[model samples]
Target: MDHDVVLAVDIGGTKISAGLVGADGQVHRQSEVATPATRPLLEEAMRGLLTSVADGASPRAIGLASAGPVDPPRGRVSPVNITAWRDFPLLDLVGAIMPGVPSVLVGDGIAAALGEHWLGAGRGVEAMLGIVVSTGVGGGLVLNGEAYAGPSGNAGHIGHVVADPAGPLCSCGATGCVEAYASGPSMVRWAQSQGWTGPDARALSADAARGDAVALAAFDRGAQALARGIAATAALCDLDRVVIGGGVSAAGEVLFAPLRKHLDGFLTLGYVRRLTVVPFELGRSAGLLGAARSALPTAQFESPTPA
Candidate 1:
């Protein structure tokens, strides 16, 4: 079978993105569809898009990057924010659609890390963390030169880690989760609660850029929460680099400047004092590229170890 190209699909809460990705990490053709909450409809939509992209090339394998908590071992997905794909057998479904080709499932953040590791910023790093700070916070880790998907495939769920005991409630039914205070929607909510009249995060960011006191405070709050989470992750894992991506990261220095300041205050040891946080290099394509990396031969790593 030709391994020159693979079918890569990135299924997020808001959209399902499919592409024919070549070995060079370039997507030759791509399509996107809005995600629906129902299982049957969502499945049908995914099938249609895949079929269209597949055409006659018949890719060697299929790679999927999905919003979790996904059971990668079994290729099953749990409840996600946008879709009603509870306990959905994703690998089985994709296999049925593609027939005999092997398919692999991974979390979106994991996929992003893989993409960055192969074709983006995490290229030469032995240890790195890829984070998506968009509508919600998500993360994937590459430890000791390999993706570290823990038991049950839920290992890189950095967003659910509690950063504040009394912060806002997260959609995951947890209070003070990092996502509750740092996600795009959460930032908008915080700004609104501060009596700033804004439609969403974009408007709030604009207001902050204009020196609106409440908007600036809201951004600071979110950045502080993110800094706390990053520091905890660095301390726990000894990560060498942190690559931040996604929609909210578009806030640029407005968000990152404060995050760096707060991260410095949180770290105590000199060993981890040099941890670097940088913007993700691949942008939106990171997930698809990372998904494709998952389908590459495991032999790429000489040691017989699970990643």
Candidate 2:
């Protein structure tokens, strides 16, 4: 059986990833490029990636996973962290780059959830959350067997949800956002503010593993902040499971154990007791695969056509 292929692009504040994906959820060919600060340079880089992957197979559609708040209806990006893009018409740009191809745009967090649902840990689940604890905290929801993109396409900006009303100021200019305390870089910054002097999240994690008091304290604070955020989401959405991903999540049990402990105390009843937190199954590929998965019908696959 022949399946239609799609060009899948995942754009974050720091990087841009592109791939040629068959309907079966496999990324047959891919490329990564530094995300340009400016829109034109970013678009050029994406065009180059698409052209490179188009060498062997013609794609019927384009699937994009971008940082929010993206105008899914218009396919434009309004990312808070990436300053150059303010309501940038991303969907139109990609459509123009590959004329006649149908395009679908989704938030990276939501895309991650869809990706996990199709090929990762969330498979067969009717309700779940995909959380990315990287440079910032972002999340997406799969509720009732569909990806939930709230009105305005900003449904999963869970990072902005206030976990500590008096916590550090966030890039969003808000106080107490989960990202302000729990993001990888934010954890490092918090540690520095505490006079720990760790250079990065990796070093901090290492020091914590060695039982460094300051490092452990910093990680504990981060874990608590993340737990607060997750608990809030679980309370509101009644999530059955959560899949945590991104660089910070690499801390493994160092992070999860504390998160679980904190969440347990925060929960009040049946919903709280049933929520399960797990590691993300696809690692870095979740965003790209999720973007590709968004292009297909949910929960099923079609074979790809021969090149």
Candidate 3:
């Protein structure tokens, strides 16, 4: 390693992105590829991306942020989106890729939160909720100026929080989860049930932008469910800010309008009323930066306990 650079990895179901982040927290070079569903193909795709991104520069440390169920005590990760990686030795494998370099593993949500706190929308907040509302809902918290991943390193799973008792069942076999109502597919499904006939959330957003009643109602419903979760999170954590990013978040005013309205309705407590919610500042780069931040040495940031 020539300098204190971080080899950051952002692993998701759709893709795996790797970057060589310099000491200043900027990614100088990066590479990404589709995530193969199978084990062997996944390994090949991931390794190639890592090698390509390194670009002949050895990194001092590696930070990996993968969708989880991170086994902190075992250094393995079982991302709910990636079925091939059930308790996969991600930390060990990444470390092995650059022998003698230290590696850190954390949940993707937690990584996003850390990244935001350091260089994005949550830059100045003491308590923040960072959420991703894409194919699924995922979230993490930075409380009292430190990332809180709990004992097993998967604490801020706000997506699974129950927003309505009468809501539909989630893929995790539970009913009334925030994800069941707020995720892109969930909103689309609800719209379809109401005879909207939309093919996907993207089209739904476009229709909503044109003021289609049914599409607007679909976003409204998802916003309501998301509101419940956000309000509850604020109440519990006394949050100062909420930053949301992902594909569904791109709906802009169509989603935020109803989200703010429902959030206000649910904010019965005066103390939590001032919480600010906004779009993610870092966008697609947040996860990579957050993963890189995990390798930096500072009290403002901390890594999940090694499994």
Each model's total of backbone clashes: 1, 3, 5
In Å, residue 31's CA in model 3 sits off its true spot by 1.9
Model 2: runs farther than 4 Å from truth?
A: 1-3, 297-307
TM-score of 1: 0.92
- Could you say which candidate leads in lDDT? 3
Could you tell me every candidate's TM-score relative to the true structure? 0.92, 0.92, 0.92
Model 3, residue 264: distance off in Å is 0.6
* Cα lDDT of model 3 by residue, 11-75, tens digit: 87667888888656778888889889998888878777877777677677788888876876789
Q: For each candidate, what is the lDDT? A: 0.84, 0.83, 0.84
How many steric clashes does model 3 contain?
5
Please state the error at residue 132 of candidate 2 in Å. 0.7
Q: Give the lowest summed-lDDT range of ten residues in model 2.
A: 298-307
* Reference-based TM-score, model 3: 0.92
